[model samples]
Target: MTGTEPLEGAAPAVGAPLLEATGITKRYGRYTALDAVDLRIEAGRTVSVVGESGSGKSTLARVIIGLERPDSGSVRFRGEPVRGRRARRAFRHSVGMVFQDPYESIDPRLTIGEVVAEPLRAHGLYRRDGAARVRELLDSVGMEGVDPDAYPHRFSGGQRQRVCIARAVATDPELVICDEPTSALDVSVQAQILNLLLDLQRRRGLSYLFITHDLEVVRRISDEVDVLLRGTVVERGTAEQVTSRPQHEYTRRLLGAVPAISPRQRRIGAPLISDAPAVPDSKESTESKESKESNSA
Candidate 1:
């Protein structure tokens, strides 16, 4: 539980686990989106969760940010159980998010500055210095050209995403859960957004629970990764270890699906391929799949 134990369920970490979820179980009617999943995130590190479309990565993110509650299990923030309204509010303020579609995420009616400033206003973080702070934040994310009053529809997808990033960081959250944040952008734009996220993490010591099916992205942004298949974590390890030296069959299959690119980095500026195949049904215990469907219905 303390300072970067990195290993699992060993103790009450000294430095504290910024976010931890134990035996999290979620059922949508009959289908179980998550099954007894345990996760630990440390401050100032990026942890990628690699999975197919239906592997429950989105479900996990929703539960983490309190958008969805698990039927069973618990989520802890800084080692404190998060269940009450106050705790959920605290989670909202401390855990920011950037969704997949920038255009959909940003309001076309609002200016870039307005969009970024909304989080502060909603969280009551606005003060006498709010205006100045907004510009600084905008500039930091490279959307300085955007007039604080210029509407979101005037900007390109990449610029809009930058606005989203600025807004998510407005509360100065300790952790950012980016759910396919750049999936809608062009290749060059994706690189810019990805780099922006990395730079912010370095400058602010932010932790990230990045969800994506893109293995190359996992290597680029994560210090470590957890591969999920059929709603369960199948493999967990450092980026180099997980990406370069996969230990599980599922993990190997995921990596094998990655397109050939320069080993040094992803082939950015190329179109992104977020539409990867789901885990094989036969691989899942028939009981587990049937059990989840019962929950889903």
Candidate 2:
């Protein structure tokens, strides 16, 4: 996902990526949160970034979506630099985000109609028909016929997440950075949300930079996967290649750590460098990426 090279025989990405981050490094004091990280998301594809907690996954997510800027790197959306007020405003409208917790992300004071229509209002999109568009988005996320005047607290967790999805896609964003949007839900509800996201992606052609620690979820949803150890990417490939045939010790250990529910759990053997010297933990730092928030819902 780092390189800009096109696949053999495949046409070029045309002009530039829908979204690209290159040589991204974010440092807080002596700690390097992101170490020369690079990621590219093409149109209509899901490139999942999978790592354990504190692996800088959220930092990367924030940087990509314009909530935070890297200390030494560049982020481009549709070939436009995501800097300055004007460019950032354009970036926010082009990209949407779904946070990990639906309840906390939505404002308690806002009704479902307001929550979904907020993005439209921010971007001045669908202005005259905002209410109709909100209903369409709600219906699209499987919350049709519900009272748009209802508050966030009245909805169940899954229902709230549906509303979140409706808001995220309200402005017809080309890319969506989903930061563990399903991790907080029950297993059944998680499945439902995942399916809804996939359906929306299919209908809207929305690219996704899905951030998660769950390898199982990655395999189910991602076309390509990046395995992050600490902060840097240790392995990258198709979901089948990276998950089933991991080439890094850290990735192998992660695969091994997954819970086995059956007697016949498949084993992913260690890498050839299993006996090699242990790699040092990435010199990473942590800070809230929520500062300098964009106009996303």
Candidate 3:
């Protein structure tokens, strides 16, 4: 069940775990979205779930974040079981999420500042400081230049992502789940957002469950990776081991698909290899040139 924002507020306990999920499993009809998944985050370590489309990466994230309830698993916060009324109250303040689609995830009705402060208002994260806290949140995400009053539609995709990040980090959340946070932006912009997230992590010591289809992205931010295939984890290791010495067949297949981009494919897609002159196929080019000369002769 998708959770509605919880009602009633409580003071967050002092110096406790950011978030935790253990033995998480979810099913839909005959299919399983997540099959007995075990995931953990230290105080400030990032764990990335790497997989392609429909591989249950997103489902695991949704379940862990309390967007969906697992069939039989427990989510914990600060070494306490997160399955009761008090746990739900703590979760509202302790966890924040940056969704894949920034455009749809942000409300168009609210100004960027309003959007950023929504969680703050929802959980009383900034009930006292108010606008000052909002500005600080914007600056924390490298969006201090943008006026809080501006509409989200006015911002570029990368900038929209910045707003999303600002909103996620507003409450100084101990844990943030980034769901393909850069997949919708230009390559250059993707780099900027990645850097921003890294900077924030360094400054705040925030832990993350980073999810993405991009191996290059996983390499940059992930300390460890869980390779999910058909709702099951096929491989789990450090990013270096997974990228350099893949063990699973699915992992190897994904590694093989990473194209060594040509100068052309760097601009277009991976088909630029076909457009290049090939050594064996050069015979056909030579024949065509001779044919042209004969016609001229």
Candidate 4:
């Protein structure tokens, strides 16, 4: 389809996958980053790709999002090939991405409002009420009181990620490709961000292609899971099926690597450490006072 034509006007046929990649292969000289990889994501669902570093998870995301082209195979969005500059541009309006490092993803020089409004402006979706839209986006992502004029450096990592998320969804894209979006956040903050993403998906009917090495995260957010090892998918199934009943040897090993505390080892309802030292017993205090008096006498 041409760029001038509203790509969103042409909807996918009923029952067709939202996005499909078939036999995608990528080579960097002799090194193969992806080997005949195939993936499909449905509407309003999460499909997680789990793998360690250099296992082609990021490569797959990039290829599907048109950041990097595969050597072979094809990426089809809404049943149309994402080919040529115009087509890729059209495809981008329907998709968005959130990167692994929130700090690195945003430009420090730009104000938060500018960063969030960028996608809207780029795709010609921004209007006279764009600033108001920016405020609404920030509020939706849990940055309600944040100053829009503030720069990226002023925000915490988690807060910056929220801004990135706001930017990603500014265009109201059908799918968001999150490439390790929570990997760099604190454990507690990770849970909050995950929840926010889930909430956004439910409210907006957005789909996610979540990429992460953490199987724990997959279990938490994924509807389907694909295990990638050495640039090849070793297993693919529902999140429950792959996590609880993994058939692949590599998948099992990956699951085993996740640290877990046994019920016996967990310290439930433990008190937080206090800054003040423990008080001495009455007997010890009396003895100390008596000793001091005797020495003075």
Best by lDDT: 4
Candidate 2: clashing pairs of residues: 32-284
Provide the overall lDDT of each model, using Cα atoms, as 2-decimal numbers: 0.77, 0.75, 0.73, 0.80
The better-scoring model by lDDT among 3 and 4 is 4
Could you give candidate 2's per-residue lDDT for residues 1-297 as a string of tens digits? Answer: 233222111112333578888888887777777788888887888989988997888999988777777888999887777889898888888888999988799999999999999899888886778888998888788775688999976666767778898899887889988999987765545666787788788889989999998887787788888777666877788788878877777777788786542333235432222211111111110001111111122
TM-score computed on alpha carbons, candidate 1: 0.82
Q: Comparing 3 and 4 by TM-score, which wins?
A: 4
The superposed Cα distance between candidate 2 and the true structure at residue 143, in angstroms, equals: 0.2
What is the lDDT, from 0 to 100, of the residue 41 in candidate 2?
81
Residues 1-297, candidate 4, lDDT per residue (tens digit)?
Answer: 011111111122235689999989998998888888888889998999998899899999999998888999999998899999999999999998999988789999899999999999998878899999999999888787678999976666767888999999999999999999987765545666787888899999999999999897788689888888777887888888888988777788899986542333235722111211121123244234334423332
The model with the greatest TM-score is 4
Clashes in predicted model 3: 1
User: What is the lDDT ranking, best to worst?
Assistant: 4, 1, 2, 3
- What 10-residue stretch in candidate 2 is worst by lDDT? 283-292
* Candidate 2 wrong stretches, greater than 4 Å: 1-16, 260-297
lDDT digits (tens) for residues 36-73 of candidate 1: 88888988888898898998998999998988989999
When summed lDDT is taken over every stretch of 10 residues in candidate 4, the lowest stretch is 1-10
lDDT of 3 by residue, 224-257 (tens): 7888877777777778877777777777788877
Q: Supply candidate 4's per-residue lDDT for 111.
A: 98
Provide the TM-score for each candidate, comma-separated: 0.82, 0.82, 0.81, 0.83
RMSD of each: 12.0, 11.8, 14.0, 13.9
